[model samples]
Target chain A: MRKLVFGVSAFAGLLLACTAHAQEITVGFVTSLSGPASSIGINYEKGMNAAYAYKDEVSGVKIKLIKLDDGSDPSQATKNARKLVEQDKVDVMIGTSSAPGTNAMMTIANELKVPFFAVSPVNVPIPADGHPWGVSMVQTPQLMVKVIADRMQRDGVKSVGFIGFSDSWGDLVYNGAKAAEANGGPKVLTNERYARTDTSVTAQALKVVAAKPEGFLNGGSATQAALPLLELRKLGFKGPFFGTPSLLNRDFVRIGGKAADGTQVSAGPVVVTSQLPNDHFAKKIGTAFHESFKKVNGGEADDGFSGYAFDGWVVFLEAAKVALTKAKPGTQEFRQALMDAIYANKNVAGTHAIYNFTPKSYFGVDERSLVVVKLADGKWVYQP
Target chain B: MNAQIAAILAIDGIASGAIYVLIAIGFVLIFAVTRIIFVPFGDITAFTALTLASLENKQMPGTVGMVAVLAVMATLMEVFSLWRKGALGKIPAALFFYLALPLIPAAIAWATAGTLLPTPLRLLLTVAVILPIAPLLNRIVYQPIADATVLLLLIVSVALHFAMSGLGLLFFGPEGVRTQSLVDFTTFIAGTPVSGQAMLILGSAIFFSFLLYLFFNFTLYGKALHATAINRTGARLMGIRPQQACTIAFLLGSVLAAVSGILIAPVNTIFYDSGFLIGLKSFVGAIIGGMVSFPVTAIGSMFVGILEGFAAFLSSPFKDVIVFSILIPVLLWRSYTLVHAEEEDEE
Candidate 1:
């Protein structure tokens, strides 16, 4: 009778332990680990791993991360998101490298009613009710391009020529330039487009050179972005060049060689972390992220894409901490609570920017989150 | 646009057209002799450029490892086929041709990868390292089904292209590389400045085309390849081996692709997967030629290049659409002009 009584008590204790351990949260992360975008995707994975190494628990709740590769394909990204939500049963989702892929994943997030954090600068469509299930960790193209436009105005540039990919990204940058133009930015002279895999942008450069704009704005990303700049320089267009954060990569510097010099780009604060003031909001967290990144990845985070992923993880953690107080994980109630907490986040300092998210505004940064950087001597120099 | 801009655009178009001509000729040559479309021709060019870039960076190219693996696989398959046919006496020669010959360049690349070799030597090494790739790929992919229909071969060729692309990503990584220009001078061409690199591309294209003309008209082996391309059975009855003809075609194709890669690496940022679009564009040129006439293919490629330049300038977003749409009218004309031959299922 005593043995039976002890067994029942131990069984009760095991049941209590199981309920206590139910606080664990699962996060589904999808990104492009292979394909053309794998270069950025690998960096995203590295930053996410670093963030995980930095902190894996929130208020005694352990977090489990399930990573999926989309191979930079939008359909694959959507399929991965669905699998993550249905099979992995994640509490919240984070992912994807490219804008299209992230937007594809966003639709799945919306349909599944799961909280999502997009690492790429995807233009999220908010419903008429002013509510969105997903938020972008990276700044919008308009926000980043505005800084370049402002700098161009300050530099007394009257006209600028635009060359970008013949895709949605190009449209995004062109739209941003047009928006900035209404607010005293330089008049955009020409909008030339080229494919990412195009061998030459000679014709586009020639058109841009013929326009004889005082400055040039490249909307292409990665190594391809350097093509128009190189061709423009060859054509003797000695105007200043401007780009967005996508050009903040070693390949751009290396491939562009001498032509990349004097090119200015708008990037997140994490790019110039060391150059920031000591008391800056992003400095403390940015430095910690760098340290943790080097400790985990064995190298400095050379591009802004990684910091975007790290910031996404940090934002997710902040919301998870709050959501854990409301309901057990893996439940619809917990996902709702998590979504609310993400929307309620205020002044959440991350490696890239200080995010202030709300239901209506999915892009959580403003002008203060950006800084102009110049490429000089194969290095990114902070511009004051 | 002014005359100067037009001239500049024309120069740019001719330079890129020259590259397409080389690649299109390669596609036609391989398809004629092997009955395989050889979709990986552009991949071979991309690999050569990547190999040269690795040499320039003083790093061991993944080509050495890739070639070694391919050589072993080709040798094993050759030995198995020879054994099945009871032609055991040909094993030594097969080993030498399929294994040792290919590995020699790979071994040289491996040995000299760390040293600061001269530019010409590096170019030669890059060409040599890539020389066996197409042939060995032939042995692995197309040899077993040598008598398959053209459509089947084309399907296999496309699958091979995707496989090569995946393997390229594994070997070269995702970063793009542009090699130093072989010649670094600009000269005025009718009031428009043209780079020396563009001249080199044009010169090489003309030189190779002339050389191909000479070989086909004057050489016995080249005649044998031409005969095999005309009628495989008749050429075999005339004592020309079709497999030998196919191998020679692939070698010549590889040389053209290698030369094109060398000429293009300085001008364009070459990536692991950049070859697909380049190859596809050239294929469009080949299709315009009805995949038969060499001179027509070259002209078609030049037209494609010039049209691309104009299209890009006129409507930047519709450039690719315009370029690819040329196929419809050309195909319609070909279908109207030519009599359809019933494709026979080969044994």
Candidate 2:
């Protein structure tokens, strides 16, 4: 009877150990699922999901994703972050597609000490003092602007006009351009701003036309970015138009149509993965994610939005692997471990960019990762 | 700003204001005859633009499906009412009026869509398809609630606006579309170059308003409409059908909305919800006219447009604030200048 009891107790102990090791690693996602910004959110979500499906399990632990919609409101996004940390007890957090929402989420991530990955381009500067427990999936605005400015300088364009949203995005792009201008790039002659949902930018377009710059830089994204270009074309401006990396999408080209032709935007390496040099760190991973995205998304070509999510997972997995070695999943120690792992990791390449997050630089990209492409015949032609 | 800049801004303002005037007129007509504020004015405008885009692409529009469904419901309601009243002789007429009338254009649109038809014919058919939606919407939504107070009707109109805008999102997706320009010539005016389409919008808005003035002044049908607008019960006692007058007003309002939409589509990108802001600006102008005088509404809306243009040049971010702030002073001036009188209580 004593021998039988010993065997049963040992078996029960083994079962408990297995269960502890098998506990799932949870990732919380908060983004705009139903609002004006839903297009960006939906595209990001699809890309993240495709990457998630491609490899769901990591380190023998099932990855559990708990997604929430913030309706694109900044307040709602903060609430979402609180819920993800306090209620869901997520090991890591990702998303809130727009800049404002992402900024809010970063604060919460810092307070809660959970590693956060932003799945879309954010305009607000991340806290540079330490690991704000956050890393951006997008190329930094400075890198994007530098690409455009460098091209303009090389092409001998002297003067440029600016039109953008009256938000932080506009400030960031303008600041980036100004930074580049200090380095002998195109001189910005005029500046104009409009709301994201505005139907007309005629006044701004007229002002841009009056300036008659050699080129124009529209600092909005998607259809919102397309409006100023459309108006400028209608007003017969006929100048080379430059845009941010955010404007590199199918909808931008499709909605803007003929007016969009000859327009240039800075793009991530994933946009033209095939055209990337073999030695480029982002090339192989970009091509792999591109193929996976196309297979899952009804043959849709991979863009930077999807590339962000795919690359975000790579960052997450890399950090998680290191975090798991130090502490078990579902613990505060594990969250802290994940953040430290991300902060310490250097030159870990995925798609979009060769991410090299450090204590001070969390955006993890520079001019090396960005390329300038012009929209011609509705296709992105690489300018090398 | 230079003379050239001022001229350009003025033309842009005038073109945009022309579209706003159409929306204001629609609000006045529908409110005058039917006591409904017509909140979906912008949604219908967006639908008209999207329908033309679909026709241009040679695809049967999502609008035809909406027409089919609404027509059936309207027909069934008309038939049921006639049968319950034992007015069997009137059933066929109701079917012909409600169902057959809308279907003819639907058939033409479906047949000619994606075909090699002349652009003018396709555009005409696009207008035809959009024209009947307002009246049918009136027949189904407004006629049932015709006896409701203006406030209640306004609420229903708001609800309809939300529904139509949502439907627009489903039909057109997130991308904004700009239709082909109706005219391509660029004319130099006052040393400032202006596109032919901009000229077309300003010219047609004025010409149509003149035509509307003539229609109201000279025709017997116009007299009946004016009578209905002046007093619904009094016109009914004089052997005029208020329902017929309501349909006519709605038809005219809808056509104006569609024409303005087509005109503005080339100037700016038209999204699913773009109409709401335009419609609201026009509402402000309509209020400036006390929703009574067409000429006053046109002038008010044009002023609103010009102010918006100047404000945009000065501070594009504050343009909306400036345009909307004008309404406060206009309302205050009118309230103080005009005599306060209580509206007659309806039975």
Model 2, A1-384: lDDT tens digits are: 999999999999999887864578989987788876787887777777778877777788889898899987889999999998899888989887777888888888877788889875554555655457888888777788889889998999999999988887788888888888999899998768887656568899888888889999888877668888888897788889998887887767877888889998888878888888788887888777877777777666546777787888898888888888898888988888988888778877887777788756557776777888889999898787
Cα-lDDT of candidate 1: 0.89
The numbered model that scores best in lDDT is: 1
Error of 1 at B290 (Å): 3.8
TM-score of 1: 0.92
Per-prediction DockQ scores? 0.65, 0.47
Alpha carbon deviation, residue B241, candidate 2 (Å): 2.5
- lDDT at B165, model 2: 86
**Residue range B1-347, candidate 1, lDDT tens digits:** 88887888888889988999999999999888887898999998998899999999999998888999999999999999999999999999999999999999999989887797898899999999999999999888888898988999999999999999989988988888999999999999677899999999999999998999999889999899889888888899999988889889999999999999999999999998899898989999999887878999999988888888877777788888999999999999999999856564464
Output the number of the DockQ-best candidate.
1
| Best TM-score among the predictions, by candidate number | 1
Candidate 2 per-residue C-alpha lDDT over B1-347 given as tens digits, one digit per residue, 9 for 90 to 100: 98778888888889888888888988998888888999999888888888888887788877898888889989998899889999999998999999999989998887876775577887788789888889999998999888888789989999999988877787667677777888989987767888898789989898888878888899988889999998888999998899999999999998898888888877777778888888998998898988888888999999888888888988887889999999999999889987744543685
The global C-alpha lDDT for each of the candidates, from Candidate 1 onward, is 0.89, 0.84
